[model samples]
Target: MKQILKTILLPLFLITALSLNNCATIFSGTSQDVEINAKPQGTTIIILGGTIGKIIRYGAKIQSFIDIFSEYLDEEDKKVLERYSFESLITAVILEVRGVVPVERSMSQEVAKVLAKIPRSYKVKVLNTFGMEEFALAPVKTELKTSGGYAVIGYMSGKKIVVKEINTRLNWTILWNVLNGFILLPIDVLTGAYKKLTPLELDMELNEPGEKLSDYQAQGPNQKILILVN
Candidate 1:
């Protein structure tokens, strides 16, 4: 009786351990660590300004219109509408009207004519603005989500030096669950543990405007410039 009980419990324990060990959710996790450094070691890195977010926001608006008026739009028309924001759509229509930006072969002429007649507004600005949130000084390690986002590395003076986009890829480590009959695959997929953030490290060179190469040569190779942002 004692031997039978041990045999039954031991196999159960081993199977449970194996399943957990092979699961990406338990072993690899959902977020990845990225190390970022700059040529000027103290330069600031900021997360801001991405076209992906805009596309997604406008796509949902276009999708709603498609669902309501299914008969009016074909597949090509839906694709064109979903790709642009209201401002961008208006600009494109105006350009098509003026023969500036060529109208695509698939674009409907009637739709373009209607869109071009809408009122246009222009606000002149020297520099584009974006909300700055989450920043770090370089030669630093940070954990980024296994989802997509954008980042900009710049000086404390607010001049953008480099723009980097973070994207996701499949985490092949989840394939290890094949040995466990893929029992834990659902958990990994649901928790996003099956994805990994690309470009695990960043080494960026800064281009400081109006600074000659001779200016940096005089400062010597070991000189460090630290700019603080409050």
Candidate 2:
């Protein structure tokens, strides 16, 4: 009886461990440890389902957001959500790119060109790649969803949050006060600046895979950002 019990428990434990290792966490609110899927590499993107806090943690010269976030989680009263960090969760889709050096300005420009083709309803930004001394991250293409709210969390890209509110009554009054209204939270969108968004005619695929450089079955770490979408 004891042997049978141990055998059952051992297999269950292995299954649980494998399951945990396969997927990223999903937080409930404004939080995450997301990585934009930008390359043929295996990068991870985590998402929550609410407001994306500030974008202070990432940009041109970030050293280590993981370290910072870890410290934040360690604080006495602070706690990381069961699924992800408080920075990313409300995302609809993630575009992970790979191949080129993360710091090349050309990389940024190329990414921008891709963004130009995305639907206006989708919130997009560049994910930074300055501190990754490790393997390239895996990236995924995205197709934004208009009817749902979104949040994005990933390595080096600034945080982005998009929601669907079809011109509410309060929004009407807010638009009447442009100057003061701009001071409120969602500056651009609240000021009617987002009304003129257009989608681009383009397609994004795995660069390495497209080039036939996928190394057959092997993956690399020099890939770009990871992606997450609703």
Candidate 3:
């Protein structure tokens, strides 16, 4: 019974930890948005970033399966498994999932069509510029939008993008970490807590240190620049 409890509780605890957006948001620096105001308001914005939460979840599932058969494994096999840890798995998965996801596609292919072309360079800019903030340390959600909706806004800096805040609502329960089936589902619906979307009014500056204006212009004219990220 004790071994069974350990098996069930360990995964449940990890899952619960995975669902905590506050903790994730605090660490995941990927929650910011970029906004640009050019003569043309609806120009296309392309963002390149990806999240790894799903991959991590999948890995945990695999590990759980392995744990189920652990008792039958030889000492050498057990040693091999012991060499790997959950935290390491999560880290590896995050690195693998981090990449580009186009947020908005270009509408027109004309010579003078409005386009805020965010080359891979600017993405690096934002990540490097704002990475030091405490909130940025949160685990990045692979999904573009969280349970609570996000918004874009203006700032004091000339051309800035920021992740103002993250508000997430979960059908949370203390037992969700342990129980399943009919019991857990109903409890979630009945006792779930709701969170209202709080406005994220962060003023993120895009100016990378030691870089001049020439660096910011990866593509397009000056007046037609805006940064819209997911």
Candidate 4:
């Protein structure tokens, strides 16, 4: 009788725990992290989101017009839209609507001139390699600090409290449920691990402070900026 009770009761507990774990991943998710290090004391550092955010907003605005047209679209129009992946189209529109705008900061002409005279190096870390499609549309929060006279350090990145998991596969955690016992329930819940983000890293070095940002070539990720100074 005890064995029967264990068999029935244990799987239910595991299922319940797993459901909560999945829900947490879907909702809370993980925050983006960027580590910054810059040189020269009192060197001004500026971090801003790039054109990707702007493009998304423009796309969403355009999609809104498409939605209006859809109301009048005939069967042929429906077929045309059907030719495209529904998930892809919707995700594109959603990302744009929720995309983060770059922060705007300008230097006074006199201050800019003074900094231009000082020679220094620059680094920008673009944390994710794939793309900005996954980030939630929101403003990035910036924090600034001094790291010795040679460098300034801080964290800058947008938050996506809720995110959709894409191109993901089942993992050992989910498979562990096959064991079907109370013993594994706690282990699964405590580990509850899942892949949530694919972030790229961008490292840039400016030979001198006098050089313009456009002069440097950077690789990895679009729309997201890990480090920038202007």
Candidate 5:
């Protein structure tokens, strides 16, 4: 009788605990949808640059692979691989210097490094630039990681707008982990379920040519500038 009860009760307890753990990961997820809209309604939104660290790391991995296999490759193949690696390194450095890609370090550290060299309010061009990856028209919805370190740029009527970065904030849903003895806090953090992207919805007004970038108000959690084309 005692053995039977132990078996049944232990399984029940394990099931209960497992079900309670990772509340945020189970409920809130690690990404959020962001909606963007512009006053003129048809502006193009461009997402530029990704985690620089990842790009650099990938390039390094490729270079290492090429070096290991070079004994079997022809001179032409070697030259092609070397050129690709060089271009990748240059691209990573360019994006990093331009503040379009975030370093692999902590956000605070990266921001501190950037602020030391550049003004806090400075903005960088996004459209017609390197590392431009994705694009959509205004009034569009897209999914972004809650970890939040990306850039967005807008283009319309031959004008361009630049948003330096997207930001993230603590997600209240992670607090639910307290009920589970914080057993899931690590999971939430690892999956980025502990935070949510801020300014999930952005609505900006498009100004005519000759308008100063400072004249526009930022609707998101970063420096924004409007670049007018003649």
Candidate 6:
């Protein structure tokens, strides 16, 4: 009787614990918690500069890129090039769009917005600019169990392909949306990446920097863990 009860009770206890924790984030804590200061509003965009030649070397057409990039900008923003004032040069833009996305990292559709869209590449023109530079969005996300009953997070990312040729530069951007299932603040911060960005958006601190991104390192259906692919 004692042996039978032990086995049954053990299973019950495990089940109970799992049920209680089900609503909470199973995989949390990816970014390093640096002393967070007040970051400037809409300044310091992170650009993931990829060589146009390389992205072409991989799969991904050029036309699809323009459409994706176009969704991000408005008619007014397009005129930014002409405005080129001290503050109106469109300054520098961040590449919030990324390459391929893995499953489970999608976000809520309501809050996401496309500010600017860049069509796909027409030629290797943009690809050759990087001189074989390695580039892609640095995956970052933070899930906060707020004091209130709400989850608060911030994230930013984008797609950037630059074709470099000594002086002449060409670039084509694309669209990439990761973590669409129930994510709230991906426009500000990503939940999958465990680092918190500082007041200045340029740098981030991942406390456990050594941890592997997502849970997988390979490709195809065999891949179980999500990844920030280039």
lDDT of each: 0.38, 0.25, 0.27, 0.28, 0.40, 0.24
**What lDDT is reached at residue 47 by model 2?**
27
Tens digits of per-residue lDDT for model 1, 1-230? 99998765543333333334321112254455666677666676544323422222223244543443345556766665555333233223333433434334213454553333333322111012222223567876776544444343333222224434433422234324433452322323486433332325656677654221111111111211111101
Tens digits of per-residue lDDT for model 3, 16-45: 432332222212233423222322232212
Off by over 4 Å in 5: 1-28, 49-133, 169-199, 208-230
Q: Candidate 5, 44: how far from true, in Å?
A: 0.5
Highest TM-score: which candidate?
A: 5
TM-score of each: 0.32, 0.19, 0.22, 0.25, 0.34, 0.18
Clashes of 5: 0
What residue runs in model 1 are displaced by over 4 Å at the alpha carbon? 1-28, 49-133, 156-160, 169-199, 208-230
Residue-pair clashes per prediction, in order, are 0, 49, 16, 12, 0, 57
1-230 per-residue lDDT for model 5 (tens digits): 99998764543333233333211112355555567777667766655445432232233344543443445455655554443332222323234444554422212333223223432232132223434445667777777554434455554442324344443432234334433453322323477433322435656555554222222233332432211101
The predicted structure with the larger TM-score, 4 or 5, is 5
Best by lDDT: 5
Q: Which stretches of model 2 miss by more than 4 angstroms? A: 1-40, 51-85, 88-137, 155-230
> What's the CA error at residue 124 for candidate 1, in Å?
23
**What is the overall TM-score of model 2 with all chains considered together?**
0.19
How many angstroms is residue 220 displaced in model 6 relative to the true structure, after the best TM-score fit?
37
Write model 2 residue lDDT over 3-30, tens digit each, in one string: 9987645433332222222212111222
